[model samples]
Target: MVTLDKDLASIQEVRDLLNAAKTAQQTLATMSQEQINKICEAMAQAAYDNREKLAKMANEETGFGIWQDKVVKNSFASKFVWDYIKDMKTVGILKEDNEKKIIDVAVPVGVIAGLIPSTNPTSTVIYKALIALKAGNGIVFSPHPNALNAILETIKIISVAAESAGCPKGAIGCMMKPTMQGTAELMKHQDTSLILATGGSAMVKAAYSSGTPAIGVGPGNGPAYIEKSADIPLAVKRILDSKTFDNGTICASEQSIIAETSNKTAVVAELKRQGAYFLSTEESAKLEKYIMRANGSMNPQIVGKSVQAIAQLTGLTVPASARVLIAEETRVGHKVPYSREKLAPILAFYTVDNWEEACELSMEILYQEGAGHTMMIHSQDDRIIRAFGLKKPVSRVLVNTPGALGGIGATTNMAPALTLGCGAVGGSSTSDNISPENLFNVRRIAYGVRELEELRETPAPYTETASINEDLLVDTLVERILAKLQ
Candidate 1:
């Protein structure tokens, strides 16, 4: 692990960074939109040029996610800068009419303090840093211990680019060593204007309670519900593709399945065809005993391993290409660790009698870990899908694709994001997929009620006098009526 003199950079260092950032923000905000676009284009190109190197750094430092997947994540992050904000104009006040009515405009919040997760360190660092820069804010990152190297390396890349582009010299900074205390100091520091937290529940909570406004997200326990109407074979293929992607380290990956009973057998068979090895009841029990703690915390060693790797742990031999290991879910709750976030290639399947049952089971399982995360469904019936969306407590309900890829925008039309906001129900402030645009505010133009005569002729009923004390009239009317009746 890298070491730094913690006492040296203290809270004061963050303050100094903020001061420089504010000056740069003013400069960038004053610059033409053309300049910002040029930087974004350059960023996208840099991301493409260095994708391989960034991916390798993530894999070596985090030791959890795969390199190829990290590459995709970095590319998405880089491209998203263009996708979400490339066309947006944030430099000058937008005007609707010559009535001195200027629309809303975004101003950089000075300094941003971000907590980068170990799961997607490199991508998160790049995404947050670039978005902050684009919004004309200065940023500092506290990388998770598992990904310190990748985080630092990415910082160097971004800082060099920004400085070369004539941005502020210290527009971006990162801690050389990030400890628990160091993180606490950063979040609670007075100069840190906002906290963009992406990680576990504990860190999100800390950010929220740090006496600053924060955008926090909760844990993801994504549940995929397969209605009887879904194509059993296609659904099976999508599920396997999702679960085994990056060995299931994705937070949006399906943690449990609620398959309609009529399709369970067919789905299981197709899953077998797609490189899944089902364990016998006895073997599943033994594997459970060895792979999880009594409290259901996954054994870290088994979390991101492939199915073949997990099978080898249980003295079972599987083909080299086996994508996922499976076991029948006889019951529910924390006792069945696989039904929760195993964060590996193991899957648990539960059978339901009907669509309603499937929805209930899926929501129940998600409520256990998802809370505010998301629920996924596959069915041709739009009404049924809408019903699930309306009834479920989940924040973002996805349909007709693998939970992992669909939720993160890989195989769907939705925005590609690494951060899936688990809304307040799940203890998160965000309820949509994370995007660079979320980091900034949109300016709106409002015209005064100039047409008071037209407003009076409108449908809404209101006494529109040139000067009306509505409150005084209500009180006077009440008194007059009471006096007359007396």
Candidate 2:
């Protein structure tokens, strides 16, 4: 009897998928912009139509988030992402400037290696597939083992639609038997051009360490600041809505709320009014041990779990009206679990003396974790908003909107995307929202505007005993010639 081990089978499957993606990408590179856009449109439509079904499957398979919220995420990926990129030019000539004598040509980055996380299974797959095809690149997805079936179904739906609309036969692929060894093979494959990594720190780190170019997102512990000049009720509503959406699975969701001491009472009252349950000191201490494991990473028991589920896990009595769990804290560090990225409906509340204190506290929180991910500021004072925007290490500063939705460009105009790329400060290649523009490289077809002598021209140094400055002479002649021509 011949029995293949799971790792060996996964590795073999990854190799085959990589080869197919490579061959398909070669054909994709020759596609016109119109052809690529049509295929992408079809894929987006197909995914959007199956959004609900896929969302349900993701929830059932992974037990991460609500199926309804997953539907919204799916719709954002399919419709919002498609609308933003439908008119984009990703193939052939992109721009031409006769005056500059340079033409920008879009070139696909070859086969892409997409690593999907269990947090956002179907939506991530659909979004990656759209942007990859829009840029005329083929992609192979390595679905997280926890959400394999849902991810596989998503890939099948979109890939079939793409192929029906003139895409290459194997332009999009997914691994049914995902393993660490298989993922390694996919990232380090000879034909793989880029790795679009969206997962845990270990997996993202592995992608970067695979000796391949990767855009890997880091952990997000964004602080939503409620300045004195902000709308208290509206700000609280936005924060609660964002943090509770999909149980805060999105990395960009707010992890903490910073309120001014002057408005602390009002903020707390409003939070309670809006279904926020504050845990006492004892409760916070008990829950802290459960938030992070002994390994110094997030505890899976609480990740993407609801308030009721989390209370049950922690053996605490929570109100049925509680939409989110709040813990008052005065510290920020890895040791302080409330100050870190929980990735669930658990939020830390901090009270500061003023907006300046809020700013410094927010920076401290981000420095500890999620350095270049996102932050939220709700304020009518443009000065304060601008101040926070200037020195923060975060890539995006969402204002007066739900962090989860706004970060993905649903309620905001930032490029609609599911994979939010944290900047170099967070160890990502780009500080973008991960769009088609990030998927392709540009080839500049430039004309030789300067002669060899012009290139050799050097500015003569200023001195008392020297010949006329060559730069001065050229400038004076050029000005006179221009005047005469005019």
For lDDT, the strongest prediction is 2
For every candidate structure, what is the RMSD over all alpha carbons to the true structure, in angstroms? 5.6, 6.4
RMSD of 1: 5.6
Q: Residue 63, candidate 1: how far off, in angstroms? A: 2.0
lDDT of 1 by residue, 1-486 (tens): 856467555545555655666566667666666776666566566665677798898887656757887787787777754576667655445335556665676656767888898877888787787777766667788888888888888888867776766666666888775677778878888778888898876798899999987888776777778888887788778888788776787778887777777888888888888888777888777777756766556676776676766777777777887888777885667666766777787778788899888777877787777788777888888889989998898877878788877877777777676777777788777787766556666667776756768766856456565566879889989999999999
Model 2, stretches more than 4 Å misplaced? 457-486
lDDT tens digits, residues 133-248, model 2? 89989999999999999998999999889999999898899998988999999999888899999989999999999999999999988999999998999999999889999999
Clashing pairs in 2: none
- How far residue 97's Cα lies from its native spot in candidate 2, in Å, is 0.7
RMSD (CA, Å), candidate 2 to true, equals 6.4
What are the runs in model 1 whose C-alpha is more than 4 Å off? Answer: 1-16, 94-102, 290-296, 313-316, 442-486
lDDT of each: 0.75, 0.93
